[model samples]
Target chain A: MRTLLFLLQKEFLQIFRDKNLLRQILMAPIIQLMILPWAANYEVKNISLAIVDHDHSTYSQKLESKIFSSGYFKLADYCASFNDGYKLIEGDKADIVMEIPANFEKNLVRENKQKIFLAVNAINGVKALVGTGYLGNILNDYNGELRLQWVQPSKISPIPSIEITSMNWFNPGLNYKIFMVPGILVFLVTMLGSMMCALNIVREKEIGTIEQINVTPIKKHHFILGKLIPFWVIGIFVFTIGLTISRFVYGIIPVGSIGVLYVFLSIYMLAVLGLGLLISTYSDTQQQAMSLSFFFIMIFNLLSGLYTSVDSMPGWAQIITDLNPLRYFIEVMRMVVLKGSGFHDIQHQLIFVIIFAIVFNGWAILNYRKTT
Target chain B: MVAVQLNNLSKKYDKGKIVAVDSISFSVDKGELFGLIGPDGAGKTSIFRMLTTLLLPDGGSAVVDGYDAVKDYKAIRGRVGYMPGKFSLYQDLTVEENLNFFATVFGTTIRENYELVKDIYVQIEPFKTRRAGKLSGGMKQKLALCCALIHKPSVLFLDEPTTGVDAVSRKEFWEMLKRLKQQGITILVSTPYMDEATICDRIALIQSGKILSIDTPDAIVRSYEGSLFAIKSEGMYKLLNDLRSYENTLSCFAFGEYHHIAFRDKMKNYSEELLKYLENKGHKEVEMMPVIPTIEDCFIKLLKN
Candidate 1:
């Protein structure tokens, strides 16, 4: 116990003494927490649009007003030719083009149908997909209105149209920020815990301090615990600061109890720090550790259900996420914060994280040899 | 009693292509200050690492403080202090903090072992608040020594502690080591500087991962077999070329400001004959005289054989 205390004291002193590292530990999460939520939004709005109206009829003008008033699009230009609308897209002035046929209103009234052309710049697939969906809804509403004007009340059957109502259970506003902030918080703590722990050990190797420590009477388990505990403390500290910023700055108040969040966070840090130490044991230099940590963090971030739904992933990829601690933590964060989920809701994930911690930390200690 | 005993200890690298420490045997008495003198890559650090239990020997077995270096590592770890080849102390820590940390880890306190490090700690006492990294090279050396001695182990390993230190600090470090010796600690120190060998009670001259000779410094110097003459003259470069070609010169190697030459035959008046020959080779203001061999001279002689 005394040996562990001394080692912990030394580690904390070293961490706080380096001003640059201290700033990075405290400042990076704050900055990223504040900025990433706003920029990483998936809601597409203010899409630039160009129109080639061959039919200067009342219906075409009405369609133009409808597109602009929906607040989903900004009209870039009104062109006489498809070529002009295409130029608007090429110049980056517009994201999509609508070309109305010459007899759109005539066909609608006489033939009971009309055709229109749409060209979407698919470079950014998400923006294009969302914009098209919004436009389709508007056109459907217009079609309904036309159907009502042409049909007489007496001719209409004595039947009612089906009505469907949707109420988003947790986030009624469907705000993407609320969903993303928790995941980003998960990433912040993971990067801080894993990268910092990895570099810490490898730095000792570089400076030749590991040899000095190895010659002491301290056990491998004691040393591993000593190295991990300090970073685990810092991880919780960073996590708290992030939670506070999410609460005050972004209004990401958790629906669940704060104590529950911390209970999960503490164990999650253990798992991440253990993996960091494992990388440190395998690498000989700080550079190698940094690269190896980056390699793992990159894969974890991509597959952690951070940006996309895990349900859409292939079967094998979903199976791989079972081994990823970030997946469990992110699920836990979103569950408790957004869904007011209790411990029972996240019991399976909690068990996985605990098991991950034991296996990783145990492997790291076993691989660390007092004699090399 | 033997403080450290190695029986045919060996280590190899790259699947035995490079032998770092060949099968060699040596031992140090309980209170002896022993020196392993060799240049870089002589496996001094490797041997220290093995004895300190930071590395495993590929062959043979060694015991430190009556504990096997491999199986009894935990026992040996508590009894040994190691200062690695590099300055391994935490650079961000203050001098006092580092000492306190090492003491506490060893299950002791600074007050318990104050006497062991007091002589060296006082010199850098004013800089106790300064970070170890910011200290001068000499001050860093003293701080490392203090930390290594803070626990008062039975045996201490010092690996090239004075490699990059200035002359004044190097001398001060040796003085501190002597004070440490008075405490009756068995010290195994390694250095590439041959001059420091005399300070050790016994010196082992090593080259290429093998021990060439082991004896007291005085005995090693006395073991020089033949006469060695220090010769210098105007146009020294040309003089060196002419002397190596001389018919009777057995060995000629540059030693700082002069060339040390040995004759094939131990005949009388060789110094004069060498000077006459240099003069005949158009040398001017030539000088020659016999000088006593130093440890380096003995090392060169041993290496030749």
Candidate 2:
């Protein structure tokens, strides 16, 4: 225990004494936590639109007013012809185009049938589909207004549509920040625990101090634990800061127990530190350690269901995400924060994380050599 | 009792393809100042590493302070102080912090064993708060030695501790070692500097992972049998070439400003004859005189033999 304490003290002294490392550890997470949530949102808004009104009638004008008032589409250009509208879209000035047919009001009044063309850019397929759906709803409402004046009272009021209501749990307004803040917390913890630990060990190897430690009387388990515990503490500290910011600044409160979140985070932090030690054992230089950590972070964040919902992904992709510990953490965060889930709701995920932590830590300690 | 004893120990890397340390045996008696003298890659570091229990031998067995290096590593680690070749002290921490760390590792305090490192630690004491990274080469060397001695181990293993150090620091370090030796600590030091070998009580010359010779420094030097001479002239380069052409020249090598040469037979009077030949080759002020052999001369002779 004394040997372990000495090693831990040495590690802390090294970390605190290096100004560059201290700055990176403290500044990176804060900056990422503050900036990333604002930029990473899947909800699209303010789609630019072009209108080609050939009808010159009150009906076409009404249609234009209704589309603009929806607040989802912006009138970017008023083109005189279809070719002009095409140019607007080709030049990237517009994401959608609406063309009103000539004699649209006359045809609707005389024959009760008029056609309008809507062309949407399909490059960003989701945005295009959403805009087209919004336009279709407005057209349907316009048709209903015309039919109410033409038909009898009984025909218009015979059947009433059943309205389906949705109330988002925990986050009633569906604020994207509420969903993103927890993911950012997970990212910060993982980066701090794994990358920093790996770099610490590799730095010792490069400086040749590993040989000095090997010659000492300290046991391998004690030395490894001493090195791991400091980083683990720092990771938890960073996680707490992120959680505080999420609650106060973003107005996101955990529906589940905060104590449970911390418990899961502690286990997850150990897994990350173990991964870092594994990388350190394989890498001989700091550059290699940094690159390997970067690779894992990139892949883990992409497949962790942090940005997109797992249910929306393809089946094979969803299956692959099962193996990512970050995916499990993200799910647990969502459950505890948004769904008000208890231990029973997250038991399976917690068990998987525990097993992952044990396996990675075991592999790391087994591969680590006391002598070279 | 022997402080360290190895019996036919061998270590090979890459599955016996690269022999780092061949089957060799040596021992250091308690309180003896022993040296493993060899050039780089001559297995000096390998031997020191094995003795310190930082490496396991492929074949044979060894004991350090009555404990086997393989099976009794934990006990061996507590009883020995090691300073590796590459100045492996923690550079991010201050000199005092590094000293305190190593002392704490061995379950001791610097105050408890202040006398052991006092001589060397006092030199860098003024810069106790400065980071080890910022220290000069000589200061770093002193700090490393101080850290290694903080626990007051029974034996010290220093692998080329003075390789890149200046002459003054090297001399100062050797003096500190002598002081430590007086305290009854067995010292096992390795160096490529032949001059430093003279300071050791016994020296082992190693080459190609094998011990070529092991004896007292003076005895090794005395064993170099030949009438060695230093010859220099105006055309020193051509003089060496022409002198080697002489039939009586048995061995010739350039040794600091003169050519050291020996004859095939003792009865051959080759010095004057060689000077005449050099002078005939338009060499000016050709001079030759017999001199005794230094460790370097003996090393070269040993390599040849």
TM-score of each: 0.97, 0.95
For model 2, residues B36-120, the per-residue Cα lDDT tens digits are 9988999998888998888889999999999999999989999899999898888888989999999999899999999999988
| Candidate 1: pairs in clash | none
Winning candidate number (TM-score) = 1
Candidate 1 matches the true fold with a TM-score of: 0.97
Candidate 1 residues A261-313, lDDT tens each?
89999999999999999999999999999999999999999999999788899
Task: Give the CA lDDT, 0 to 100, for residue B1 in model 1.
Answer: 93
lDDT over C-alpha atoms for residue A176 of model 1: 91
What is the CAPRI rating of model 1's predicted complex?
Answer: high
lDDT for model 1 comes to 0.91
RMSD of each: 1.6, 2.1
Off by over 4 Å in 1: A155-163, B266-269
lDDT of 2 by residue, A269-310 (tens): 888899999999989999999999999989888889898788
